[model samples]
Target chain A: MASRSPLLAALMRLPPPAPVLMAGSHLLTRLGRKMAGRHPGMIARLGPEAGKRLLLDATDLPALILLQAEPLSLRLFPRRAAAPPSDAQITGNLAAFLAMLHGESDGDALFFSGELSISGDTSAVLALRNALDDAEIDLAAEFAALFRAPETVVRRLAVVAGPRLGLSLTRMEALP
Target chain B: MMELVCPAGTPAALRTAVEAGAHAVYCGFADETNARNFPGLNFSRAEMAEGVAHAHARGAKVLVAINTFPRAGDADLWHRAIDDAAGAGADAVILADMGLLDYARRAQPQLRRHLSVQAAASNADAINFYAREFGVKRVVLPRVLTVAEIDEINREITVETEAFVFGGLCVMAEGRCSLSSWTTGLSPNMNGVCSPASHVSYETTPEGQDARLGGVLIHRTPAGGPAPYPTICKGAFTSPDGAGGRQTGHIFEDPVSLDATFLIPMLQKAGVRALKIEGRQRSRAYVAQVVRTFRAAVEAADRGAEMPVGALAKLTEGQASTTGSYAKIWR
Candidate 1:
């Protein structure tokens, strides 16, 4: 499994400015909707747990993310902003979160390694993790699809760039 | 040669385990029919069938775990799970409850039965009784047995024995712990979860990160440090030190998982037929890596080669592991 990316941490020495944050948040919101649309089974799999509000705190990033699961909405808040009320929170660095999202690292290993922190309603967090794992989301592919870019080229670029940049851009090799 | 029995919480994990060289993959339905019934985990009936077919296609067996005790006035649910597992083409059904075992024997004699570790059958007499009465072909020995004791039991019993070689170590006798139920009103034997996540919470207090189970503070880690899961047995606590003021520590058990990779050959020599890994609620990535590692270890043990040790330290709970009762170091 890919360890947490030190290169990513080094790059986040300065938080992104407000305009960039706004633009990224807008893009991510649309991406979240698209992902929910593309993988309806993931949401449905949560059963009665679809209404949970989860906080994703990337300790190295500029802002924290508050994700509302039912409507598939994602909103960003400055790291220093008043914390929103959430059912649960998962705190980790960007690389660890991305690696878990892309199946490059195991969530339990990350937690066991002290790279991730979990608080609040752990069952909701577990539900989200299981749903995301089943969905098999590929961050690189999701961005490529959202931008109408050719998936193969983007995938090749991600496969080449991901390691160097300390990111898990694409899904790990599928199990045979 | 000891078979590698891997756990799968989902169909994807099942496929991953089979591809990773598991001789047999164990799983359960998406209900309280088995332990590790965490949210969004386990398989539906259709998925179980497909998973069985997938594993079988790769020359691997699938064992469905309907291991939870059937609730009073709700045994039909457990009965249906057994029938569905058999229908899904399971090679065996791991069961713990006596009623369920007898039911499986009478209702589906063709389906093999493996006594679950939850039965806590740690001796030759109890194991032999289960084999004779319920036609149990294999018995998953509780984690409390030492290698010498296991060897002694093997000498007296006829059924194949399976022992946990890796993963979580219960502080109490398997299937008999009531700590979670006393605290949260949910028991693994009945509800299929110990320390059910719904009752667990964590917070960063002035002192440290506090983990609470059922609104009771269990563990307090140093500020910004990693906190272990709030299972009652693994929790930190404070109690009056008899004549003195008070003492605080993990009074029951430390937050460490069981890792017996170094004892594979010993367990094999003890007549263990299969080695079991314990995280059905873990991710597919975790399952794949662990199964692959144990497969190599099992193969090496067969070849009389040195087994890989400490390869899974990063994957263990609190990044710490113990040989558990296998070494009997306390004795």
Candidate 2:
């Protein structure tokens, strides 16, 4: 294979069985290996409080997660008990999970529909809700750097579908 | 003596109120033109005219409410409501929206206009702005002001002031809330409905019975417990504490109604022109009981008699009532 890019080299250096990325129904495991050589700080802003509060107040939460999907891959586990080789895994389906975060889908309804099943603290899920409302995620800048990448098809699909689906689903869910 | 304006949702309620010695009675068209757009309530235009005739013959005034905001591109309905109220010989028409106020002032300069509580004019500056701009003769202050604040406002304003003595309490500032719209796509300002019944759903599970509005779980009561309607702000929610624990309960307000009956004397002394009772969705019997009780209280106040003990407790929502932002210390 051609010499891996510097970004990929840095990502590979991180301890991993590696994270997975799930886009809508499409699932990709161990995808973060591609960016092994990249500086973590280039994207990960330091400090837990800053990160926590930023996520708590984000308005465009689904958009942020959708953009992140293009550059990072995460593993999907059936339950919290399932052994994961890496500690940095992020997992969830794009369409339904994003819908719930936007307040378009109710937790009870999605749980009943078997559309949402999470192994994490539900409070952490709510924290994500608050964070999305609190965070100021700039999709333009974040996506600009990754727009031309070969893997951006899923990200582009999410960009087009997330808001429209969220809005329509909210209306559907609102109706008696 | 300050006028005691009581609610009259039906013709029987109108007669009950007039008989019980209300100084004035306020009702609305049997349509969306009014704020209390509850089903099977309010009066028809003919009913209103007859009710006015009855109240007038009894030496009491009648005010018509055309208080809800007019929809975008559909101002004609509200204009017609104003004209109808004027044609029916209402003593005054209570209004809220600025555009509607201007239209009424231009269309029927001879008719008196009372500012509706939905305007949420809690301060003298806003009250003066309305009075100077629309020639508003009186203002029904929002439920958010304390007696001291009301006194301070009366000291500055030229128009007459009305304050709520009893009924439903709105915790949020009126005419400016969107929490209802965010949940149900309907709003008090736009649809004359808050926490509309159509969007509410209840579900029973092994854990509890969940009350939902627009599909969001707002409250979960024990299986056989009474389920309060899920009004967004009053709903139970979990909030995180600084030390990594959860605080679960009503972070805003508990489910309680407002009853400021004991403050009548203080309100009158504060230069109030009227004390308003706030339930057009209420039954005629409820109206009669409340009107009779308040009439006695107001008469006693006028004659310098001691205020009566509580008699309207059963009429309150949740079987519990509050003075609601009136004490200021509650804040």
**Highest lDDT model number:** 1
Measured by DockQ, the strongest candidate is 1
Q: How do all models score by TM-score?
A: 0.95, 0.62
Candidate 1 lDDT over residue span A71-144, tens digit each: 77788777876888998899988888988887667898887666887888888999999888878888777888
**Residue-wise lDDT of candidate 2 within A16-68, one digit each (tens)?**
22233244213322323222223232122211212221111112222112213
List the candidate 1 regions with Cα displacement exceeding 4 Å. Answer: A1-19, B224-226
Cα RMSD of all models vs. native, in order, equals 2.2, 21.4
For all candidates in order, the CA lDDT equals 0.88, 0.64
Instruction: Name the top TM-score candidate.
Output: 1
Fraction of true contacts kept, per model? 0.65, 0.00
Residue B44 displacement (Å), model 2: 2.2
lDDT of 1 by residue, B46-105 (tens): 989999999999999999999999877889999999999999999999999999999999
Give the Cα-based TM-score of candidate 1 against the true structure.
Answer: 0.95
Model 2 agreement with the true structure over B2-86: per-residue lDDT tens digits: 7999987666567767887899999988667887654345677787888899999999999999989998889998999899999
For each candidate, report its DockQ versus the true two-chain complex.
0.65, 0.01
